[model samples]
Target: MIADFDVSSDWHVAAPYGFLRGLRHEQPVFHSPHLGAYVLTRHEDVRAAYGDAKRFSSAGSLTISRSLTQATRDRLGEHGSFLSSFVANVDPPDHTRLRRSVSRAFTPRAVAAMEERFRRLNEDVLDRVEPDGRADFVPGLGHIPSTKLTARFIGVPESDEEFVKSHVKDWFMLFLSPQPADRQLELADSFLEYLAYVDRLVAARAAAPQDDFTSLMTSLIGSELTHREVVELISTILLGGNDTVPNQLGNSVYRLLRENIWPVPADLTQNAVEECMRIDGASLGSFRYAITDIDLHGVTIPAGALCLLSTDSAAHDETVFDDPETFRIDRPNADAHMTLGYGIHFCVGAALARLQLRTALDVLGERLPGLRLAPGQPIAYRKSIVGRGLPALLVEWD
Candidate 1:
């Protein structure tokens, strides 16, 4: 069955565990013809690969699918070269400075400061949902808070928040999804427009200082980072922060409810969120290019080969967690999951995201302890090699 594994197939995105388990068991590191890249599924291999960023470079690695066609490439190229400048894709010295500059604005102190705001935002959103006894879980539960908090996180003004919410950069991930060519062909032009809009925001922030993240970044620009770097960093935060966390809200609640484990004990629920993320976490990991022909676990990855590190599968590796496949609310060591990523490239907004998830779920459970999946409603997950997300989730509370 491992021989037949196909990354491009619909089944792989929706349900890959059966074959991913086979890869970790039979071949920890093997190149699959279907994926057109070398894959590492075992926990040890995935963690090591992430830690060895010196050997495994992150350039030109925005997605794990590696499916950009000549047409998509040309369309994307017209925008600008800033995509490669993303903090996640840059190597060592450059990565160090970029991350430092971004962190300057997103300090742990700053993240902690947002907790009260998030708690209120959580209350505000849920306050509306409570009266209905039913609500759209994905947006009502996750997207709204993610979008609002990120707007606050990035320092965008109230007038522009709607635009920020509208262009969540889901299109960027859609490029990797299994959509029709025409629909796929449609993303780049709009992306270029969104890029222009962000460019304007960067300019405005630079001109008139504000208390938000963008103005803070302006202070660091030139002295610590390039103007282009600011654009990339903000773009990454705006889009990435918006896309992943919202979907995770739906996925986490969905999993917990399906297992009949909602209203998780307050003591261990945060760990339950950690466990939720480990199992098929945001996007199925990402790509790293081998700097030179190298060997790992007896498998030789050629020079210039793209290695898709299966962080999702790694979570399930029997060696890491006692039972990765199960939803365990009381797991002692659940934070070990690599859902938000690892090493220097770990998500800058992780603390803020965690506060959002914990606050949202805790609020929902306390307010609507009997939330249930709506009858006759089918669950939906957006099809993508990266970005494991749901568009909507319907739930009712008696």
Candidate 2:
């Protein structure tokens, strides 16, 4: 049954609720052959599942596509101890410790201080596009600010900025598609290169630290995290911080332009970003392996079962948001949407993402007053079930 759903064309649409809505209504814990796991779709059920991490563990493998080759898994295994350092892969006490190490960096005070830098970065990227009057927003302006900001945040040298940005797409793509062996090896090489770069950054911070995430990480150098754990944590930060924001930024702009709203108002752009995330977030859903059998809505989810919490469905739940299909910027409850997962695994970088989106829109609107999508060109979407965004969004202005 799971395999059947996996191969279905509808799977591409993501919100498979149109097909599985009945199952969710009758049996919220139906087994999906495609995923080879039990899917939890209802908003309430997913919320419950997310809140009770004790019942649904996060320690195991957590991707939907069960087709990942053993080679891919093996490559991931190279991290070994580092793998457990990422907050998403741990449970409870460990997750708490890892999350705290970097929590101060994301506080309201810290993010507010970075607002001007974000604005300046946004303008700098837009300036490059202004002269062309046409540009590929994703790889062009869209990726710049986040890449620059993330590098700066981690205290990585400015010289390595371009090198780091160049690999962001490829690194993200490995999980998005099944690439040729050579391409996979190249990505693995890039991943290790990035790991080494971060390791050096960590060491540099320890030797001569500054007020940055790297410095904060350095403070924990002799604590619970060892040198390898530090490297993994930094790698996780780079991976998480790099791709998602840029994609969200690009996708939000693409969506606004596609809807014929060029030069979207900052407030509206912020709203649109929220809606896009709710509608088609980069992360399709987060995975958790069931630690024990649990019955939900008349269906039994067995122990060791992989349970998926559908963020897309939860966002569109009619009970939660009225007229879930219609994309309205003025929707009152738009802020309540959960593109970021709920409960324990809720995205720690949510504020950073919002800042990027808000800054992007503000700068673009102010600088490119006439920005709009090119009349006849089709916007190309990145091909990935795990995430969604535009790879190239060509646009022109008056």
Candidate 3:
């Protein structure tokens, strides 16, 4: 029966729900032809997989499509492992060290210091939209704030602003879908270009040493990281900041508009963002590899088997949440959503993402009080399990 199942279509349509129901009712640990991995769908099972990093390793090629070429893996491994130091791809000791190196810059104090700057930037974007009373919120407002904030964090000059934003989106897209070979090479080229740009910035920081993250990272240049490692580290920072925040902002607006809400309260916007991410996360699930044959909730998952934790389903589990299908801003446990992930590999930028989302909504509410979706137009959904969001969010205000 499982052999005939169309895993791709099933995953594409109902997403984690399709897989979750199957796992809970029929097979808790079953192989998926599309992902070529064993999917763990139940909330308890996903939580177990997340908590036990020893039993479930993250240091492996963890893509849904098992179609990656050996050359691609070798290329990634050689360039100081573009996928490695990002914290999402590594295990304990190294992950801990790499994360700590940049953690100082993202502290609450540092984040709070930028509030005035963010407010100004947000208002500037809002001003452009106010005159027109309608705009594509993603590119116009949503993408700009996150991209600019990340640039500030890395101390990349505002001159290179457009350059960074242009390439970053393509980098995310490559991870989402199987693009053509030329497009793949173009994506890799864009990444290389960004890395080279950071290299120059790092060198400048070493000479002049400004009071910014670039200087902080540059201080460790000779001791902790080589030139390439520094580039990869900054690239990871840019990628993380660039990829998710815009989607969260866009998804938040889309949800609010869909539900026919107006003057979205600051608290409601926050709740709506959490619920939307829980329901349609930028990432469908995260990947792990079983380190040892282990029995979880009566299901035996063999060693070296690829594992998928259905986070979307975990957030919507009927056992954990009441009326899981409803979008309730007032839900008591709404903040406990799993979109940022859980346990060892939880999103390091969770706080930053939240701040950006909050700032966007706060500014939008203040400037565009009557914001609403354009009547009868459909919001386009982006295709990618790693990141799910609207491609565009069209809105109008009087």
After superposition on all CA atoms, what RMSD does each candidate show versus the true structure? 2.1, 2.9, 2.8
* C-alpha TM-scores of all predictions: 0.93, 0.90, 0.90
How many residue pairs clash per model? 1, 6, 2
lDDT by candidate, in order shown: 0.77, 0.72, 0.72
Model 1 misplaced regions, further than 4 Å? 3-10, 63-82, 174-181
Instruction: Give the runs in model 2 whose Cα sits over 4 Å from its true position.
Output: 1-17, 20-27, 62-77, 80-82, 175-182, 266-269
Residues 218-326, model 1: lDDT tens digits: 7787798887788777877888667888788888888888888878778866887788888757757878999988888887898889888888888778788886677
Clashing residue pairs, backbone N/CA/C < 3 A, model 3: 282-387, 282-388
Model 3: residues >4 Å from true position, as ranges? Answer: 1-19, 61-77, 267-269
Query: How far does residue 183 in candidate 3 sit from its true spot (Å)?
Result: 2.1
Ranking 1 against 3 by lDDT, winner = 1
Ranking by TM-score: 1, 3, 2
C-alpha lDDT (0 to 100) for residue 24 of candidate 1: 85
